[model samples]
Target: MSDASFSLNGTHPTVNWLGQVRAPGTPGSLPLIRQTVVEAAETCGFCDEDVAKIEMAVGEACTNIIEHSYSTQPLNLDIEVKVGRYDNRLEVTILDYSSINFAVDQMAAVPLDDYIATGRRRGLGLFIIQSFVDKVEHRFVCGQGNELKLTKFFA
Candidate 1:
């Protein structure tokens, strides 16, 4: 199926922040995403530290989405962040037509001890992301793009 265009949804109570971009996926999107998501979360009452973490983690997740999810005229991705009172969490979901193939668990259990032992300075994005988020989930279509869900809860 063709990717859908990005649109504003004004009816979702929980959708405090959302944005979609079709530009060429690049490293530069990282900073832009971090700033936008964090600013929006702060507006919704997320703590400063929590906001910073969420921004960083979400930026990493989005980078993964862009790099791994779509190919050949990439599809539009939907990002939705809901800031709640009890949880004060940021929920991010990516939409596309590609099947889900990324694994957060595999990424989370990074064998940090080995890395530390070797003093390796790589493969830190996933590790950093797991440290920030309380939960990460995956919803995949049979032959469609995967929805990568990332959440960061503020304490």
Candidate 2:
């Protein structure tokens, strides 16, 4: 599904947009979702630098979802990318069917020096999302799915 849904929430109708992209859990589908997110952020008046940050963070999150959550069935899984704008923030909610419980508090940021010295590349997506966005809310409904809400506030 590549259709976009629009809605206004406590903001000007013309300034708010919501788009959804559904794809199989694979790396190849990331660019399309990333582009959709970046375009939505741009429409919210985000500068180039901020838009790039949002793109990078969203890309990392999507990658993690596909890599970790759907490792067994990456090509057959359902992944959804929801992009929206409201007030002074641009938000993106990524919904996935994976039932893994995410612990935000336990996913602390590693020191730059330690990460560089170790040269290890794992468990960094959540950190990137936390650092790039002003607010993050995660919800896992018993029967529905996991919702990762990322919000980047305008400066």
Instruction: Report RMSD (Å) for each prediction in the order shown.
Output: 6.5, 3.6
Predicted model with the maximum lDDT: 2
**Whole-model Cα lDDT of every candidate shown, in order:** 0.60, 0.77
lDDT of 2 by residue, 1-155 (tens): 23344455835443344577998878999989998898888777888988888998889878877877778643477889888766667778888888675544247777667777998877667667778788778888765667888889878
Residue pairs clashing in model 1 are 97-144, 97-145, 98-144, 98-145, 99-144
TM-score of each: 0.66, 0.82
The CA lDDT at 139 in model 1 is 69
In terms of TM-score, the best-performing candidate is: 2
| Per-residue lDDT value at 64 in model 1 | 66
Count of clashing pairs, candidate 2 = 0
lDDT of 1 by residue, 34-107 (tens): 66566656765777787777777777777766676543334554433332222355566544454556666455
* lDDT for residue 148 in candidate 2, whole number 0-100: 86
